[model samples]
Target chain A: MKSKLIIYTFIICLFLTGCFKENQIEKMGIINARGIDKQEDGLVQASLVLFQFEAQAKDITKLVKGTGNSTKGAINNANLETNFLLDSGKLQIELYGKETAQEGISPYLDTLLRDARVPDTSYMAIGEPTAEDILTVQESGISMNIGQYLHGVIENSASDKLFPKVSLVKFSRLKNDIGVDPILPVFEIKEGIPKITNIGVFQDDKYVGDISIENKILFNLLDESLLSEWLEITLPFEPFKKYKRNSSSSTTEKLHVALNTLRNDSTIRVTDLEDLTFKINLNIEASLLEISNQIKLEDKRVLKLLEKEIEKNIEKKYEELLKKLQEFNSDAMGFGSVYRYSKKGKPLTRAEWRKKYPEVKADFNVNLKIIHHGETF
Target chain B: MKITNVIAPGKRIRAFYLFFIICTVQLGVGIMGAPSYIFGYARQDAWISILIAGVALILILSVIIYILSQYENSDIFGIQVDIFGSFIGKVLGSIYIIYLAMALLSVMLTYIEVVQVFIRPTMPSYVIGGLILILVIYCIWGGVKVIVGVAFLFFILSQWLLILLYDPILRMDWSHLLPVLDASLIELLKGAKASSYTLLGFEILLIIYPYIDNKKEIKLPVFLAIIYSVSTLLITTIISIGYYSLENLRDSEWTVITLFKSASFSFAERLDYIVVMEWMMIVVPNNIFLAWATTYGIKRLYNIQQRKSLYILCSLLLVSISILKYDYMILQFTTIVSNMGFWINCVYPFILATLVFFKKKRSKHKGMNTT
Candidate 1:
């Protein structure tokens, strides 16, 4: 009995002396958002937007800067400027400057991939002009937590299909994937607030071009991300030109129609892999929300006309988008991935796909259905 | 020589604990990264690979249990002695113990690697290993009864994590799972071969056979346990395939934890931290049960006290973990052990069952001649 007691005491003492030296939350600089910029001398300037842990702490946001040849070195250099050990457990968003992103994003993102403490769901974006300047902005009117602020900017737009959802996990996976390229939300700081203005397109980890906000919805529609939302599209009021062209006080309000509960399905059929020709079918389902133009709701002819008009408009816009992607040799639409995984295609390397993608032609087929017209008179 | 103390096989256990013991032991560490292992080769067909592996393992496990039934309430250690005589039998027993210890070491180190990646990055590996080992040592010191009791309790508690998969399921894009049956025959064969190791730890029944009561009733529970674990793995793998795109699923090193990140409530930001910590309850039982088996082998072979063997093995595990460097090296170590275990635990049972069958026939003939 006495011997057992001694052994128990020895075991208890070991626990009392913890093997893990618990890192106190107070002594660590918890970074909220991080930004990286490339310099002319091949060094990177890392900017860390740190947040305090205390619930009622007065100064929650602090921007710290450091420069080094590599990302890890730059982070360590940034650590030197702070009084506490720097930590990235709470890192919410990572942004890269235009110069750094165009050169290649894989090198800057490698550290985040290697670090386990970093969350896979953290949002990533490309900043226009410079990421350091975006992180360094100090606005009294803005709610100051750049991490939450930037995350909200992207999250809100992503929900509306204006921006593609680009988390670190998807970014890392897409960069390594041969067929599908990665697309990250790109932002430009405007009027003291960051705005998601364009979608940055990457082919094999290097940012080559961007799709503007005007084309983002169309891209997202083809990508099937525009499902379960309302889309407002404007046409040139074709009926008005026929009816009111002779009137001196003619109103020139374009035809506006709201597509509600919108959903899209895309099918990529590889036809003749030797010829590098693929056919894509996009079928969309939705209900009409509002229409600014007065059209006969009971007329089957008008409904057909409306469907054909929307399909033609989408086909034209998608053709323009496809032409740009092919010119850039970017498979941001994942057409090559769909082709490679299809039953009748041979395996192709990313370089080979890049070469073949420029020559690949897609024939678009759009099917549209409007289930509800909102109690039309 | 029968073990007379509390750790002995004489203390009868319910047949149901067999279900939880196999489950708690096999379901740890591997399930978290199961998708990543085969996703690269199988692509979106990773779930189908998991299903194929599970069926093959169930067939193998049934054969192992049937062989144990032939020996009649005697565990594999005694059966080894009965079949090969004392000298050769004890030698084989010692080799199995070493194999089990290596398996235990891999599971422990993999969990420590997880802690390093997801839980505490700054803390040293040995420290996490030491802390978890201490909990394991306590369970081992209490004997098989304590290990079985904890396994049952942890299995029940950790099951709620299945419900959490619904959040990721809500985001499932069914089109990602298209191009079905695209994996060639050779790719699937290799995938099944790699998955044999993940289906290990059911062989724990070989060591724990004597303790379970109702010898005739054990088969049903064992079958249930296999079905439960197989379906659980299948569900997670299917969820992984549908939730993340094939391009992303292939690179998801921590598949389960990454899935949990998509599960968010209104109040919480990082849901993975909370879900991952709960997995400790599921992981610790694996270490304790295997550690106990290692010591049991030592006591039988060398006639040493179980306490002394436990101390030596725990210290050895601690020392090994201290020297482990880098994340990939931990992965490399576990992969090597798991590959070796695929041969020893998964395939060797079938071969041993055949040998045991021939030995049983000869003994029966000798008894008939005496009659």
Candidate 2:
């Protein structure tokens, strides 16, 4: 009787295993990125890059657009137009239009984060002008595909430390975090080609402003220790200032010495707890990447001059950026987070910190060392 | 009245299965959201709570081992029958058996809740819960040897899931762990108390002790198993704390599953699906062992066959699970269940052990001979 029961159980198991609703590869509209923008009529326009695979062939790409009152509504509207049901299980990135980003991305992020199907590591960025237009831009020669292109642009820069890796998860943390705001890589169509040029800075989810690529590299330095060589600095020195055979010639040509930082160590010292004064010290180790052929790297004095000039320029630029941060009342560098989390710093609310930020004093110090010269030296 | 012959099957478990059994049973649906629960009480110093809980568990488990040593060759049911007369002893054993069934219910319901949340959201809860029980019944049918074998296999295989934390570790903000020692001593104590949920399943060893072929060799492996479990909890707690801010972590449910959403691979997506699914392997043993314990209880108390008792238990379990099908209530009921488990498993084991000491000194085998 027991042996018969075992065989009967196995027979019932075979019959019960058929409830799974299989998602076939060919019939699924695999979404790679979803772009959300606020339309002029105040409706939320959502767009997606849908992947369609061919049997024994390369997959074809398609775009589906929809406009509705909310992100979920817009996605449902887009689903109406597609043959295969939209599956966002593979969503690689989420892009927001500049205008929509300024309107705030927290709403769209709320919908995405609520969906267990969405990957938390999806890259987040603000597309200049509008996310719809940016999502539509495509090129085959430069990029393998638009999603790969767009994702590669941000992912590459993030790894290079030009911008922080602001994913849906990290962005939500920064958004809800008391004292710190978040930033995202910015993309714009430059002469019909999509490019990630700068990062849009936010003050409490509002796209207040943006920093240039150079300033972003410096901003990233303040935020975290980076091992990258994307930081290239240009310095003009005396040797190339007047490269004529005779110094008396009085004709001067600039020696544009370019050095890339190979490694950087940044530290924040809360010098005074009362006024929230901070001294951000950056120790940079660099190598000569490019130079005008006039100056030689073998000369230690020349390297010293270049290092000092670069350091001085970095300090000046960083101070200017700090001043700009005060102007915008932005704490994207997480200074407020640093202070709030620190043991001794007095805790304050987000509004109070933002209110007091303009008056908070910040000092900048950059110490650059020439770790290696170019291939010649 | 042959205690060892009744519990021990022809195919006995080796000492190594003790390590995997203790570790596997320790981890389950509780780990899915344990960090947040512990953090809710202790905040960033929750890892310290796990350490304290581990130390306390070491002392408590040693006490249990000492009690087992007092009984020359007996399980908890046998010991109860020896200490008390058959009528009262049978009643206490029945209560204990019901407690194990409730434990089986709680474990099954918790995994069902997780499955609904992460995987089959639209599927019927009864179907999912019933399917899992079927698998548990299959494993339980294989008896203790098969159950221990599954635990051993899964313990070695599931260690790789820890590697999924690499991406989150890279992205984590270590400052979140700051303000260390911020939670007071009392809060840390409450945190340790809250941690008892995840640490509760190890006491199943009390029932399965005699089946251990090398009882003498069990201590080092069991101690290592506790160390393994404690460190896993410690590291996962620290990782979750450092990965998400305290406020966010508290606000977030299923701290571990939510963290798995961030795990990315080149070939796969939504790694949480993989995690929540592969996590079933770890949870099944908890159900199997508890179900076996209840069945083993039936065999000991009423002198029925183990297989028949399992069918009755799982059938009754199916009805109970179907009745408690609502997710929110199950989630709420879990805390109550864990508190009860803490009493029954952690505190009461020692209490029973101390009772054994008193009963032995007072009457010894006098009650046994009369029974």
**C-alpha displacement of A237 in model 1, angstroms?**
3.4
Model 2 chain A poorest 10 in a row by lDDT: A242-251
Q: After superposition, how far is residue A131 of candidate 1 from its true place, in Å?
A: 1.4
Q: Can you tell me which runs of candidate 1 are displaced by over 4 Å?
A: A1-28, A53-59, A138-141, A158-161, A225-228, A239-254, A343-345, B2-10, B39-49, B166-186, B235-254, B300-303, B324-336
TM-score per model over all chains: 0.89, 0.91
**Model 1 native-contact share:** 0.42
What digit string (tens of lDDT, one per residue) describes model 2 on residues B112-178?
7778867888777678777778888888877778988888888788888889988788878877776
Chain A TM-scores, candidates in order: 0.89, 0.88
* lDDT at B371, model 2: 86
Ten contiguous residues minimizing lDDT sum, candidate 2 chain B: B1-10
Which sections of candidate 2 miss by over 4 Å? A1-18, A40-42, A54-59, A138-144, A158-162, A223-225, A236-255, A344-348, B1-11, B81-88, B363-371
CAPRI-style grade of the A/B interface in model 2: acceptable
- Candidate 1 lDDT, tens digit per residue, B1-371? 44212234467798978999999888888888887677776776777787788888888878888788786567777777876788888888888898899889888777777776777767787877887888998888787788899999999998998898997787665556767887887787677666655677887888887777677888888988888887887788888887765656766677887788766667976778887788888889888888888887777677899998898898999898888766777889878888877887777788888889998798899999999
Residue pairs in steric clash, candidate 2? none
Question: For residues A1-377, what per-residue lDDT tens digits would candidate 2 score against the true structure?
Answer: 99999999899878876767777888888889888988889899889998877574464777899889998899889989988778888788898988888877777877777777777888888888888878888554455557767787778864544566678888888877777788888888898887778778898778889877668777667666666546665554453453323323333344455666677888776778677898888888877777654454466776677777778888888888878877888887778766776635344588888887787777888898888776674
